[model samples]
Target: MRMGKGKTKLMAAGMSLTVFAGLLAGCSGSNKEESSSSPKTSAASPSASGSSAASEQPSKIDTSKKVDLQFYMLGDAPKDLPLIQEEINKMALEDLNATVTFNFTTWTDWSQKYKLLLSSGQPIDLIFTADWTDYQSYAKKGAFLPLDELLPQAAPKLYEFVPKDMWDAVKIDQKIYTVPATWKEYVTEGIAYREDLRKKYNLPKPESIETLEQYLDGIRKNEPDLLPLADNQGYHTESIRQLTTKTVNSSNKVPYGLNIMYDAPRDVTSYWGSPQHLADLKMYKRWADKGYWPKNVLNIKDSGHDVFASGKAAALLGSENPNRFNDSVIKIKSLHPDWELGYFPYPNAKGFAQPVHPIHNGFAIPRSSKNPERALAFYEKLVTDKRYNWLTQYGIEGKNFEVEDGKYYKMIGDAQSNGFPREGMQGWAWRNPEFMLFEKSFDAVLQMFSDFDKIAKPDIFQGFPEDWTPYQAEKAAVEQVEKQYLYPLNVGLIDDVEGGLKLFMEKAKQAGLDKIQEEYKKQWIKYLDDSGIQ
Candidate 1:
């Protein structure tokens, strides 16, 4: 019931990054502190058999011992970070008898900084982690501590509140290394159109690919100034890929050479040469010829939805989350009250959207932490306790927000930007929607969860933690090959589609596409067999 509350609209900015954000949501939580909370008493210690007897025991925090925990997060330290940190520490002192410091890796080169942070093994108690943030890789490399034994003692409420399947998702080889943030979302590509434009032109509702084409054609013929569809940094291609191909379960990180078909045979195959890819390319090429999009779409550096928001375009394609609204769309609606936004949740008739991965973002203690017991105890309260969760997510009540009719409303002024407080990081970890304030799209977001539930399919390959170590060399070469060859082909920048595909295939072969396919096929088959999918 609280799942869709106060969700922020996510943008599909860069192609690879956008998809990854949707697939793997957790980033890092930051700072430096001693590992002071693990139980030194024999009564609280985990058994050598690794049984969860600790969960059955009364898992109470030691009130006598005080501790300090350092937390690291993904974004740059905000301007109001210190002010929020002060309030956070005050709450910690009262509730958990601990003080915490927070640090950040700026957005400029976040991935590299995140990698370095984990690989360097600094004294971090809790760090923000998610599938996208290389949580699996770090966990596998012994950078993170296995958390199965600690959860019951440190976070009993969370251990019970989080579903078993979700916990199963955070596991690598039957051991959980991270706590997953609970949220309800459906990651799918949808078509968004200016409702006023559709009404004016008497365009058909954008319910399917064919109707979407009709809508685009109507705009192309009627709207001289606006494009039928817009592309910023090749987003349409990515959106179309989700629509056309069934994503291979373990193919989130790898960009090329995995052949995955949705209609079964669950074996790996070359997506580049898949019939779906070819059909998508051809459809896009036709749209380009009809002037539905700009001729040089690949070079357009402006954000697609931004252009759509400015009323320069009639339609745009990007990722859609039912439980959230696009921030750009919200801002546009705010400025132009007459321009309403309408969404068609799927482009293809299949209506098959990827369910929101259960573990989008959450806190994790590193192997270097000395006080994981205290760290998780603090996190437990962060999610389960109302006052603590509000402070952690929205910041000081009087200063940052106020409750009216049991709903959070940000105080006007600097704190009221984009439905989030300027004083703190938007709730990133252990996010409890039950404590959240609703946005304008709150009703629609909840409706999306219902709609997607009926139409969406659980990814058959959801739990396989992809290990890319063996194919690193091949992956790197293929990435380069894609940049040089596939980019132009997919975006309609190339004149001869056949010639371009031939050259792309040739380069892919040289870059070890065949080997990549075999590896993917072998692993995929094993996973299918293990899962009893056949």
Candidate 2:
């Protein structure tokens, strides 16, 4: 989903947790390596013909008995919520013979807080990490201990539960470090518009970018006063980035994937970086100039849910998962009771990129966990152990939620429960799946995966290490300049092309594009040696 050091080898076959074991177990093989930017794969196997002391046995916790783990949560909640506080603690203590105390933080400041926590050498046991969140950065700092050393002792069931290879994918520097949440594939944002608006405009669902332009234009023609494409306060910049760059070109097979994670300084990444960039800048400026979207777009400070829900916006940008959600459908229904909004997208329009399952948020245990055995046992029970994973994952039965006529319904939160988010129950936790127990009311969302697979691509990218992040900084600087200056100039805000570009490049060079690139190539090569990539 993001960029990396180089090309990656796709897994030989789609694997289950068991099948992935062999790959992860012997991951430290001396085989000639590939790109320093290569993603970790399950290449190791389980202990083969091996015998060791019973203390080396990973399953049994040294139950001199009572244990407690300080779990640091990255997102917000009351210090407690949903009546599970006492219940979860009681269960952990009773079942695993362990107790967990949580420290709460908000998502807005989670990154800084987490970084400070880990770097401060705080004794945090386990945490929830995500690719799109903090996993890569922390792994690079060597913050979390390698699972190769800890798992066998602390997480035997987890070792067995997730198979070795999937865990291998979480490795960095040949050491298993992070565990990804198992999620159904097909996660990426795309165009979502009101079909009723399309009908009002006599437009067809867009199948290609070419058609998207036509559709946007059609919306404008039909509703001249309406900013045909309205972005939530949050999506304006994101929308701009997505439409202008090849960031969404998931077909690339380079180990770095789409390069969306860290936008390279060179405009095309491999091509003339600034030319087509200026072209796109002008293109959007044309939209702004022509008034296709709101002029106050840059000032939005909240979720686009309102614009999307208010019947004011014609289209909203979101991932396939969100679009298929029941809550989204419900929100659309309530906002414009008669409106029929539906998703209009192609997972891979050119149809070549591998349909790598998009994993956003998930969990990981820190090496600092004093009771690795109990920690992983807790994780295993949280995931595979239905009852425990359920309470920790959802909530205590019946109070915050309930099982209605077979479906899990909410009597506590809003709609489903009091103040509950009804967009859909099908959230993709790193470990949680929308099983029958969880998917009761969200039947339509279940088909979202199968429907997407028919269209998902085969070319995929791999995850890369952290040292490269700084190297990519120069390109990022250039992109920022491009976004700030070149784009606006192209829109005729400044008007001179060659002249404007020259000044922009000059200012950018002074801002250190060349030095940044030089540093990137130099450091990237060193990282190659460190990672043992050929």
Q: Assess candidate 2 and give its TM-score to the true structure.
A: 0.69
lDDT per residue (tens digit) for residues 1-534 in model 1: 012321111111112222433332231111000012111110121233322211333346685678889888886565566877787788789868898888877654577788788778688898988666767666766788888988887778767656565777667778898887655445555677878888998989877678889998888888877788867545677665454455433214234546555545454556677676677777777877888777777667556755676667888776343332354455565567677888766524454545545455767899888788889887776766666666666666665566544442434334224233422464556655344444334445445654554544445544445566778688778878887888777667777887788798889889888877777677767765565554
* Candidate 1 similarity to native, TM-score: 0.75
Per residue, candidate 2 scores C-alpha lDDT tens digits across 233-258 of 22333443443344533322122211
**Lowest summed-lDDT stretch of 10 residues in model 2?**
30-39
lDDT of 1: 0.62
For each candidate, give its TM-score against the true structure: 0.75, 0.69
| Overall lDDT per candidate, in order of appearance | 0.62, 0.50
Q: Any runs in candidate 1 off by more than 4 Å, and if so which? A: 1-82, 93-113, 120-124, 132-134, 217-232, 245-255, 265-267, 274-276, 285-314, 326-329, 351-354, 368-371, 395-404, 408-429
Best by lDDT: 1
